[model samples]
Target: MKTLLLTKEEVDGLICMHEVIGAVEEAYKAFNSDQVVQPDYMGIHLPSPRGEVDFKLGYNKANEVISMKASSGGFIDNPTAHGVPNGMGTILLFDARSCALTCVMDGSLITGLRTGAAGAVSVKALARKNARTVSSMGTGNQARMQIRAINEIMTIEEVRAWDSHPDTLARYKTDIESEFGIPVVTANSKREAVEQADILVTTTRGKGSLVEADWVKAGTHIVAIGTDQQGKQELDPEIFRNAKVVVDSMAQCAEKGETWHPLNKKIIAKDDIHGEIGEILVGKKPGRENDHEVTIFDSTGMAIQDNVAASRIYQNAIDKGVGTFFEFFRS
Candidate 1:
């Protein structure tokens, strides 16, 4: 059998933000229809102050493909010590029918793109039609991708951003303004960013709540992206009290994502959740019924997202002859 090997650059070249958003939206629809088989993510945590590696795997029955991703992060000193980023990931895709390893690709870019696409999907389904201002609480790669994806789906007039590092915030501002021609503003505080936003995004690695409930407006839509692990929080638990909370996966979010804190502390119950984003995508449930309703999308990241995105990229690579193909075994 032959396996296609793709680098991060090659994968990036194969995918555009609009295509990713479409693919991720379909993946969510498939998931809601019970056309996907996904397991909970498993993680191996290193000692405190270090990092952790996580494994996420799933199959899209509709697409007849399976994928597995191994991702690691949380080592703050990686850049200084090893000259590498704080996080890294790789993806493996296989044919379900033949059980053949069809592709091996860098998953770091896929991770960011799909995550951004997930937020875009939520924004499209939940955010108000007049949501012209977007706010982000981090100025990193994920934040950039989130803005890019949102720009593809919605007409964002202004972006308000905040970061602990001033240089990072400035760079994010410059990049967004240059690439998308959208006005970018640097907020002096997180509260200022949240209060001014019609659509709020939290993509930080902080382990505590960065947004308070009172800071959010009634019509706001929040996409929480950073709380994919236990004890990592970005939104206040009280924020879920009167909000229409939609999660990527109920089981996954209940255990690891932003829903965990609220569910754990009895701030909210599972029944309080409106539905998974898939349900909204499939039209089994409604999204953002009224403009005055506060809505929150708790994104924990899903393997099916990776599988669907990788599958799309793999096919694009094949059609464009973008990646290297090598024989791994001979029959």
Candidate 2:
């Protein structure tokens, strides 16, 4: 039998931000509702080159497909030293019935969008209905993706941005204003941005706390996008202590995500977490009970997202007659 192969460009053309957001929400629902079986994820570290690749494997009973995603990051010299993106990935999709490899595709776009959508889903579930200001703490690629996904679900009157790199910050303002047609203002400092935000998103690759608990005001909903890896933190643990914290996965976050730091520091106990995003989406728990309540969503990313997204992309390719087919066993 032949296996389908899809390039990154093809995959980008096949799915939009809106569709990716919907698929990610479905994945979360399936995962929290006990329809997805996720195996333990594996990470391989490379010390000399300073890079890491993580493998997330799972079976989506809801979709009747098995999927594995491999994402590589931390190649700090890729852009200036090399011509390609620092992060690259590949996803393998297999048939649940026969366990046959069905398709192979570039996983970078899916990985980016799924994570971006995860933040959007959290905002949709927890942010106040009248929230109009967004403060983005970083001006990287993930920052752009998060803004795009969130714009699909909310009305943003203004976007306040802050970054350590002045050039990157300036470019972000130009690109976002041109693309979204919304006012993008550059903040002089992180506190200046965080203090004025109705919704805040942190997308920096930092190893220290970036946002202070006191900087965040009441009734704000924050999407903590950084701190997915061990030893990386963006917000003070005190922030977690004061807010209604929701994680993408309790087990994963407790060990590696933002939830882990707060636990290690004894600032907040495990019970302090209100619930997982899936739980909130499935109505097993409440979200944003009142406008005055402060909420934070710590997203470490998960496998169910990859499974559902890859499944959707594969099916769409088949329906649209896209991708290349080659015999995997060319005997």
Residue 108 lDDT (model 1)? 92
Candidate lDDT values, in order: 0.94, 0.91
Query: lDDT by residue for model 1 over 37-112, one digit each (tens)?
Result: 9988899999866699999999999989999999998888889988988899999999999889999999999999
Off by over 4 Å in 2: 79-83
Superposed by TM-score, candidate 2 places the C-alpha of residue 141 at a distance from the truth, in angstroms, of 0.5
Q: List the residue pairs that clash in candidate 1.
A: none
TM-score of 1: 0.97
Model 2 over residues 13-56: C-alpha lDDT tens digits?
Answer: 88898999999999999989889889778888888556888999
Q: Give all candidate RMSDs, comma-separated.
A: 1.3, 1.4
Poorest stretch of ten by lDDT in candidate 1: 41-50
Positional deviation of 136 in candidate 1, in angstroms? Answer: 0.7
